[model samples]
Target: MQLLRSIGFFHGNILLFCVTTGAGIFVSPKGVLKYSSLNIAVSLSIWAACAVLTIISALSLAELGTTFPRSGAPYYFLKRSLGSSVAFLSLWIKFFIYPLGIATQSLIISTYIIQPFYTRCPAPELPKKCLALAILWSLGLLNTRGVLTVAWFQTISVLMKITILCFISLTGIVLLGTGKKENVAKFENSFDAELPGASQIAEALLQGLFAYSGTSILINIAGEIKNPGENIPKALITVLPMVAVVYILVNISYLAVLTPQEIISADAVAVTWMDKVRLPFIFGSIAISLFLILTPMIHSPKVEYIYGFIFIFSGLLGYRLHVHLNQRSVCFDKITCYLQLLFNVSPPEDQDEGISTGKKHLEEIFL
Candidate 1:
């Protein structure tokens, strides 16, 4: 069946926002600070620079997406611009990378969630993995329903996450305004201690880039978008800068409450920020709620990994079954045909026709 085209401009924007801003924002600041050697100014500057680079990348990709919007976007673009072989390899690599990336992010979320609850001992890894798996499967099942359901979930969750970040930022402002001046002076003195070298800056910029990694996801689902050409570009331009601003403000908020060193040492920066600001009881509850809301949205893209494996395995099994059946004598040709039809061992004629049409359109636009 053809995919439904129900995602509009607003929904598209929220999907991009949620994907881009996700768990990275809550966790990356600590790595940024560590990479920058606890220099708040340097880390924030890296974040700003990466944001600009991400926007530039999004704009270029947006133009490409508008011109030739399709599912399997990266593979489609590669196949058209380069060749089929390159595209095939890209698809294979993506299949491997998707699961690994999802598992890592899910584990990070679980770790952060349990960190605050740990009193003496550290958070256990077995529970973390179980929690991560639970999140992955839950979201995967949710996505199987329809893209519209996923869009609504993304919209609400992203807004809640943004609100939580804003609340944390405001709390930072309050703390900075009322807290003693000595702490600020001490932080300033440390900021000016020694500038990081080029290598260190580059490493820190990588962390910032990781936080901004999901901007291109809009292109991946372009086939389902209501107005692929108009909505794709609009969402990229509108949501990216907002994501950047939120990232910067969140970092600034972290600095507002704790010194650069404290942020660098923080295991979970957002949780630490709440704890240090002395709002653990109030903001802590809100932050936990935000994370729970954030989980499904962040885990949505990862659902593609599960589907990817299913498609790959099914195709392989069908091909092997077909080959086995083909080896039989000519008298069995009728039976082989029946089995092929029953098991769907070959691609449907209409699907090939649709793919040809899509390729022709892409060629007309690009060639």
Candidate 2:
């Protein structure tokens, strides 16, 4: 069974960059500002600190990923280093967490999409949930085609997102140079304001960390990446710092255009920045939609984890019941097939051989 190694170093790096520096940049600046007692400098500092910490974590995980280079990275790492139960638990937790993240991002996208249309009345909740499911299933199906399709989609979307950010940052820089004294004065005064408490600072850092959370995504699809050993680490090191820089610059852009108080009060900081700059509503909505789309697409590879966990758990339960009833055996071919699908590998030429191999592995752990 051969998996496609279609994702090159460039695509891998861009994917990691997009995933780690997500829609959080659009919303988190406001949260950090508000929670850190409206201190713009402290919020930006926390963002930088978290980016560094995230880079360190990415480096460590890159070593592990390149060494093992498996499709289900966390599962393989834990299974070999600890045991099967720990690996299984990790998959189980990821099953819930990843989908929840996708759903949350989808809902956010739906809200932003409907915001302009529903200005006269409250947007309906059912349509939002429906749109979320639609987006989830559509992306899941797109991923099932092959790794190449997913990689290309991620690369294009990420490039577009970065361009939008660059535009926003440049707009801020231009505005700053042209006598935007009101917000500049407020931003300058903020540097001398009282600093936030340690707990408040910690909370702000956590928010930044959450924004930088997807740096390890390359590891999840290690088997499908071209030259995993070289590309995995290269992508991580290349993208993490770059993403950190983008985050900091974007936050500065937000502060440059709007005062700290304006940012803290903004429901969506990027949109607010756009409004402050008097950009058209259509362009703002497009940027917001792109951010929403890119955020969930970061988790696209994890869709397999959901199916993998279900099949493994069911197989284990069937095995237990067979043992209790003293039956001859519980079939394990289904488990083998599901695992191959989960890893996006073709089935072996000999089905019996594949099932026997899988059954032996499970028997060692469960029997």
Candidate 3:
């Protein structure tokens, strides 16, 4: 039986937008501001550059999606275009790395969602973890219903996010117009802050790049995308720039209302912005689970080489693990699913033929 291409442009747009706009938009403005050495001009420039890269990445992924027309996102494409080893590495990352991010985002949402009750000290971990688990389980149940069900939820969520972000932006613009230009009062002196060194700039760029992190997520479900050639590009072209503009405008609003010091100090930049204006709003988030991926950049200087080595190591590690496992007849995916169950991570799904190909290469190389 074949899968239906039920995910049309509308759903695709939601997926792209919602995945790409995560807690980063709310939180990373501070990182962007901080890493850029508190320079507003440098901060905005980093954002603009990231926005352009987002477009480029989406367009490139569209070409690849249409060309491969495969499900399992990078898993299949990397196998076919590059090799099984590379694809196998992505499978490992999907299983291992993604779940950390998922948990982080969930906790962020839980924190913000429960913040109202505490209103003073931090929310206790027990309640926060319970709420996060409830949220994760609820979404897990929703996913079992099918793609469209998930898409519809994303649609509602995306609309709420856009609305709040727009509210923030418009409010900032109004403040600027009304002469409450706290950060941008003197536009001429905006660039007066000294630029940081290369390491700091690179760190700032990473912060900015991650701001557009999940745009490539559509490729994960590329096979489900209706008319991959047309709809993929259309959805990306339609949504990303709009997100980019929102990000910039929101940043401007933050600068307009809150000073750079406040931006850097706040726990959540958006939350702080809202608090400053006394805008009573707190919406549930599914995207805050995506920010944990930023940790490696902060911890390592040789990140590029580290990433390359990890992929190579994953291929070798996968091969060795598969060889030792007694279930020679079972596919690698079934084993992955078992691991998922144990970890409370993304539970395994039925995979396509491409997944088997990863292990097949190891079989050929060994036997």
Model 3 CA RMSD to the hidden true structure, in angstroms: 26.8
- In model 1, where do residues sit more than 4 Å from their true spots? 186-191, 280-367
Off by over 4 Å in 3: 181-183, 186-188, 279-367
Provide C-alpha RMSD values for all models, in order: 26.3, 26.4, 26.8
lDDT of 2 at 149: 79
What C-alpha lDDT do the candidate models reach, one value each? Answer: 0.80, 0.77, 0.79
lDDT, candidate 3, residue 284?
25
The candidate with the higher TM-score, 1 or 3, is 1
Which 10-residue span in candidate 1 carries the lowest summed lDDT?
A: 327-336
Clash count for candidate 3 is 4
Top-TM-score structure, candidate number: 1
- Candidate 3 structure quality by residue, lDDT tens digits, 245-300: 99999999898878889889876666677677764232222233333444555666
Candidate 2 off by > 4 Å: 118-124, 279-367
- In the range 1-367, model 1's lDDT, one tens digit per residue, is 7777789998998899888877888878888888887777788888999999999999998877787777667778889899999999988998898888788788888988888887345688898899999989988998998889998999898878888888877766666677668435645655576678889888888888988988888888888898899999989989999889888888878888777777776667777777776555677799899888678657775776678779999988866766756544443555544565478676546988856754654555446
> Which one wins by lDDT: 1 or 2?
1
